[model samples]
Target: MTQTVTTSAVRARASSPALSGPGLFTVLLAAALPLVDFFIVNVALPTIGADLAAGEAVLELVVAAYGVAYAVLLVLGGRLGDLFGRRRLFLAGMAAFGLTSLACGLAPGAWWLVGARAAQGASAAAMLPQVLATIQAATSGGRRARAMSLYGATAGLSMVAGQILGGVLVAADLAGSGWRAIFLVNVPVVLLGLVLAVRYVPETRSPRPEPVDGPGTVLLAVSLLTLLAPLTEGRAAGWPLWTWLSLAAFPLAAAAFYAVERRADRQGRTPLVPPSLFALASLRRGLMLILPFSVGFSGFMFVIALALQRGAGLGPVPAGLALAPMAVAFLFVSLSGPRLIARYGTRVLTAGAVVQGAGVLLIVLAAWRDWPHLGFGSLLPGVTVAGAGQALQLPNLMRIVMSEVPPARAGVGSGVMVTTQQSALALGVATLGTLFLALVPHHGMRDALVVTLLVQLAGVVLTGLLSLRLPRTVG
Candidate 1:
């Protein structure tokens, strides 16, 4: 069955270019929006809270609501694209995302903003998987590798750039909207993306269409909500009894989701996530490694932003500017990732992890030495080094994970990979950020941040170890 699917997908790819050069750019432009939105709002949260009269706990909810919903429904969104068409879903999602961004910008209350954010996340889930799927279905060989690399670069850069752009927008407070400008900014971008998508983005879908796995879909959603909801929201909500109970149920729900998916696959039905996809060792292990890398990366970003602004008394623009060195280093190094991956194979990832770990250690040491006087200059060495290290790891990991995924299962493959990444990112913030906050009340903020950076350093080491299990080289 897997061979047949691969053969069919290869044949489809042989027929035509799914997108021209200009069209590919349009797809990538659309792809960057969700990732940008994810990180952009982090810097704006405090401003949003002050303006909306929201407390810290509610502010956490505002972020988690989008992430959790986005993670939970991703597989379903991917499957829908497979069932219908990639271009169609892409356009629909883009339109909805634009409307939701508008809703978020105009929201008068915290709860209303939170709801709009969730809607935006859902639309993002619908939109993003198609980017990977279309690339997969449309291209192969060097074309495919180049496209994936561009996607990886876009994904990594958007994360860092989002915060920087958000700070500028909020600080500028265009038309007195203040924090709302972070979201409202998406409206114009989305509109431009819509225009380009309609003109250039080509429609693609699985050549061998399979029925949607209704039971698998429901089980997966339940499993994700069960796992992610409590973890993300629990820390902010004071870790009530229900949160603990929810955490306990996660493993069981996950087991059930797998069981249902496996049964569907054996019965020759299209499972929400095909069991066969896991047979690709590169894809499987690359995904496993993505968990720790994504989690630690996100945790570090969230905590460091808070530490710079709240702990060190930097304003939003300065806080955002402080990360500019990291972003610049990330982009510069990331462009060379494909060449490095070709030469050094997965060793590049290991090298990146080692560098990143060292960078984290540097940050800890800097915090210890500088204490209350920490500034961007003091933080520069560690952030630049760490950004270079991350630039090496993230894009390479993305290429490795998707390397063996046949075009026919592109939607499922991309969905599974992204869901793991998104979930881990949320978990990192919940666990590490929570630990920092918990320790801050007891220890000084400087000490707490140092300890948290050390914890992230450990995660980087684990990722380095996991990279050893990957294939020697990526496609």
Candidate 2:
């Protein structure tokens, strides 16, 4: 009787609508939106500031607001999908994202843009988790692996392509839209995503859905705000007393959040972020690796945008074009990732780190040798090599992270993984960017860039060390 019931349950799950190519494409497109938006503004910030007469601090808020909102609300978004339906939340989030992007594009002042960006971030938090959750719930075996690889490729490419696209759009200045084009472009894409999502995507949810965890949710928000707010805005805001107070409160809030989660787990209730999930080696180690990698990745993107435009005297288009080599190289290597992972296991990630580190060294040497002459041609070799290295690691790391998570916990697991990555990206911008900016005045652009690259090299080495601990074989 027990065997019969178990088999029936398996059959029922297998019978649910599986994700097709079009469906996967749609969701991957959705996944690209938030990440692209995050980096797209890097090259556009100067234009935005000039056009709006915004100060340095307000411009920083424009970026920090979106990141903080996205990071803090990600877990809640995931849980909501598990409770209601992934497809439904995805559609609603997509629509809201479109509307918010319009608001951003139409903003009259700096504070207005900041508010719109915050709403856009919330919409992204709601939309992005469902992509991973849907993929987890609907596919299995090699098919799932392939979809995941594609998703990773899209993610890596989006970060680079975003800056490139932003430059192109800003240069085009469609109907005199200027810097606003970047935000406005999302409206049409979101509209298409909604249409396809309705036609192609399938709805899925946890069989035993749990209600929202109020205390865990509140504490998590507080914890993230306390940590990220001070770090991102402190330098721009002159390290005010409130920033210090917020930084001091971070540890306590984080600890309290953990305690509440632990208590909820013991009492047999769902928490916003379950502490027990970290017990899985794949998840814990994968996140550790992701943190350093994402930090270096985003920090480099931010720094390079600033350096190319301000230090090298390049226009927005030229500044964005400098990264083309990296984007192209990343796409090529990422496509070959699954086959390479099959043959070499997790060692591939270690190899990627080594290659990326070598590329970073090359970039540092080039910066030192050719400061004023730095351009697309000078950056070609280093960026190309680094992109190839990143391609090898990111998708494989994503696969390893989710390999052991059961389908029932898909939403939560995906939430946690994305939250970690998003938070690290923000941290990267805060710490490395702050360091670079501070050094530029005293040490000059060339020396400041060299020092930053060396620091990033250290992070790459740490990522390589962490990769060694991952499981030898992946599912």
Candidate 3:
């Protein structure tokens, strides 16, 4: 009798509504908010500092605080979704995100803003994993592939648009809100998302959800903080003793985390991030590709933003507009990705790398020859090709990473993949951003920019090499 009842319950849950197109749109909209917020502040940081009398270190915290909190809690959020419900957490997270944005908008001081931003990051961590997990549970085959592609499109476009929109909002100064408008703008969008989510989004959760892995969770948090904290804050904070100590502790924490997770897997217990998940050729190689690609992608974004604004004397709007070519190219190419992938398989990623490399080399030459006169016209060819290449790479990689994930393990798989990307993003900003800033003082802006592009090209080359090792076709 007990076995019969359990099987019936499983069937009932599986028979629930699959994700409709409208529902997919709603969840993808939710996914965009966090990423947008992550990059939105980049352009507004100078304005924020001037208005709040914030120094460099505090301003860095404004960014770092949000990133650290978002990353640390993501895997836990995924597990929670599996244990309770995805739609439930989605609504809660969206509501919390709205309130936190309001707090950030109204904050009167630097520390207050930092606190609010940290809370906002926590809210995002709660929200983002459900997007991928929900899709994984609700869709299959071609539908799943298309949804993942759209999600990737939304993510890439949001990162670029956030900086663009931030520039516009800060300049527009709606009712004289200035930089606060960047955050305040999220309120209405979140409100709309909540309404749609309640109406259209289907509820989903793991059929055999496991209890939270406490030891694995703690070790993972320690491992990330020990590494990311020092790298992000070390230069601005004068390389304090504590920062060095944290850096030294990272490898130890990481090793311990791996050991614990492996032991749990060996014992047939589900860990926060199961070591067993990496056995999939697609997931493993896909992640290896994503790390280098993300590092280069974000590093280029940060370095270029600084170069255009600080060195070239362009205002925020113009600086943001400079990437319009890339944005447009990414959108068009990504829309066509499914068709391309159907025909060419994973070789598309290799082609993307070659195109992106060519674009980077073009940018390097243009910067070298044009110097401070660089503008939209001079950068159009390079940015457009690079954006197309990125379009080809990012969406397909995301689809590949989760291609083999079972519906029951969807939440864990999504969480692990996102955590890896988020950590790489933060690391990119720390390492590449630091390198660019450090070089500028000695080598000057143009030389520093060129050198940075060269380094990014090297990373792109590495990604191409790694792509060769992936299974020739995705599931």
Best by TM-score: 2
lDDT of 1 by residue, 1-475 (tens): 9999999898756644467788799889878898888888888999999899998878988888889888987887788887798889999999999999999999999999999999999999999899888888888888888788888888888888988898888899899999998888889999998999888888888877767888888888888888888878887888999888988988998999899888888988778898888999988999888999998988988988899889898888888888898899999999998888778888999999999888888889999999777778998999899999999999888888899898778888889988998889888988898899989989989999999998899899999999987768776
TM-score of each: 0.96, 0.98, 0.97
- Give the Cα error of residue 24 in candidate 2, in Å: 0.1
C-alpha displacement of 58 in model 3, angstroms? 1.1
| Shift in Å, residue 363, candidate 1 | 1.1
- lDDT computed for candidate 2: 0.94
Relative to the true structure, candidate 1 has a C-alpha RMSD (angstroms) of 3.3
Q: Which stretches of candidate 2 lie over 4 Å from their true place?
A: 1-15
- Model 3: number of backbone collisions: 0
Clashes of each: 0, 0, 0
Name the candidate that leads on lDDT: 2
How do the residues 153-175 of candidate 3 rate in per-residue lDDT, one tens digit apiece?
88888877887888888888999
**Residue-level error in angstroms, candidate 2, position 430:** 0.4
lDDT against the true structure, each candidate: 0.87, 0.94, 0.90
TM-score between model 2 and native: 0.98
